[model samples]
Target: MATFIKIVGSLIETLQKILIQGEIDEYENDKQMHCDARLVEMLDRLSKDVQASVKFSESFLIEKIQFLEEVKGIRLPLFIPHSVFLRLLKKKINSVSEFPIKFVNNVWGYLETVCAKVLIDQCGNYPKLLPSMKKATEHVMSKMKAKFAERVVEMIEMEKITDYTCDPDFISSYNKLMNYHAQFLNLLTSYMSNSITVEGYGSINIRHLSEVPENTRNQAFDLKMMMTTYWKIVLKRMVDFLALQLRFFIQKVVKK
Candidate 1:
């Protein structure tokens, strides 16, 4: 009877051990799955953010390009040479002192109207009336590059706040993610240089019209107008290319 009781006690102890081991194994498996799910969620959010940013950038660039095109179509007389307008005005009017104050105002108004008409006529006939478009494209590209870089930095910073464990696999995955973002930024820079940059200028050059002499101001205005046209064309092309590339990138990230 005593031997039977000892055997039964040993059996009960073995079963209890087995049950506890099984519970522990199950808990560990659940924990691992939870961690993996969290990682997946983080990665998915990051990818979506990148895609959204790209879409926003594409839309913004397209809108800006359209605005520039519209500006190009507007007839602005500011590009006309002041000297030429002044000479024409002198021919149309008598001495300035011969008029009363009211007459002087009328005469100035007439001069402005004639100047605007002549400027429009000349611009319509002459291609050289506009300035260099390269300058405007450069300005847009610079802004794009800067904005893209800033966005990448922001993404990286956000990722650092995610709840990743200090395990080898997690660390490796985080490192790879950061490296990929860095590569993307470098790719953007490369695209800007290869696709957007025009020869003869490296940076945007802006001159204040108020600070320039009247004769040179007209030339400056012409240059500004030319830049607007150039920006429109280049921005359109860049937005198209970037949109396609960003879609491709998002697909690749999702697959990974």
Candidate 2:
């Protein structure tokens, strides 16, 4: 049993290395192996799908504003409520949670393919060992995908539950977005048009927001700008942090 386990471990290590480092000849150039390149292409497509799935709550901004108003008290919304901000963030995160799971599932599936190919190529002399190897690789693939799926769901929940980041870009982006706050309100009241044009944001429809109570408009805009700025940070972190984690994970698995 110990020998069988060691063989599976070695097999997993070999498959992981190939997926991470790609073809040995192209390793220095950082080019993906032919099969691994397909996985990368699929991941890129999944990323675009996730990006399209979640968007600024443009149409729903009024609903969120109304929700805040209903929960308001004597505070006059001097500041955006943390609970409200979290509510929006969670809603946004939940929308795209499945994409990550799908991505990890497909990634492990691709790795299984790489393993099978390697087994076929490397075990050509041991015809009887091929069946056992194929079985072991499939078992490892199943376990790997399940583990990743659970961790990814946990991660998505963490993002929804915790809103913390030290990136300075959030403040800079928020400041730029909020520069149009006064303009947003003015356009809401203006008889000239139903939309406001802000740099970087282009035309934003204020048709629904015009009716937002004066006392709460400031808070609503604050919520919007905060969500806008922080969402960018969240998306960027999801991409950057995942890349770092994946690299570390592959390296750790290979080293083992």
Candidate 3:
């Protein structure tokens, strides 16, 4: 068992190294095609190891939280142990595919709401999450134009054309829409918190490395920068103070 764990851990570590280094290479050289092929190889190896391990013990949640954090997106962590899945299987669950399918659907639904809120905030259209083959940009732009046209019609109907900015009802309606979308986001959060996926394998939220776009990369970088600034101001100050106190305590211990 120890040997098995060691092997699996080694594989996971190698996979992580490859992914990290490949991402850097892709970013620096714009060699996404090469990176994508490497990613496919990595995924194939990881999946095979994961399946073999799961057959032996089920609930092995891989300890790679930092990697996910570095990516700047909260997702279903890979390398789940067989023991965890076994526990879920013992719960008399039906339909193997439903859980993962629903999990993906729910995640996409939550992402859609997030997109809507972001679009509204930026005065852009809520973009749909379609399959890789689908051309969704045009559809999203069209939808945004329609939404804006509808808003214009509403403004005219309300007779607040000149002073629409001052109309509380219009603002309230927009807020209400956002709030409704937020409710869906909350549902996803709740489901995740309750370990629905762990309990039933709802969806395997495996984000492909190839899917990381330039815009998303920029957003992730910006978010990390903001977080670093916040942490430096708050946590860093506390840590420094605590370290000083620790140093004084150690000196006292030495004197004794």
* Clash totals for all candidate models: 1, 0, 17
lDDT of 3: 0.32
Model 1's TM-score against the true structure: 0.20
lDDT of 2 by residue, 18-58 (tens): 76656544233534346556765866776677666434445
Candidate 1 stretches with Cα past 4 Å from truth are 1-212
> 1-256, model 1: which lDDT tens digit per residue?
5543443344234323322222223234434223224334444543343233222221212333333344443345444433433332232222221222232233224323332332333344343432322233234434444444444344334323332223344444334333433333343444432122212322222221223344343333333333333323322333343334333432332222
| Candidate 2 segments exceeding 4 Å error | 1-17, 24-36, 53-60, 69-75, 251-256
TM-scores for the candidates: 0.20, 0.81, 0.16
In what order do the candidates fall by lDDT, top score first?
A: 2, 1, 3
CA lDDT, every model vs. true structure:
0.33, 0.68, 0.32
Predict model 2's lDDT versus the native.
0.68
lDDT for each residue of candidate 3 in 153-251, tens digit (9 for 90 to 100) = 342233211111333344444343334333323443455432212222233232221234434433332332222223223222322332343234323
Residue 231 error, candidate 1, Å: 1.2
Model 2 compared with the native: what TM-score?
Answer: 0.81
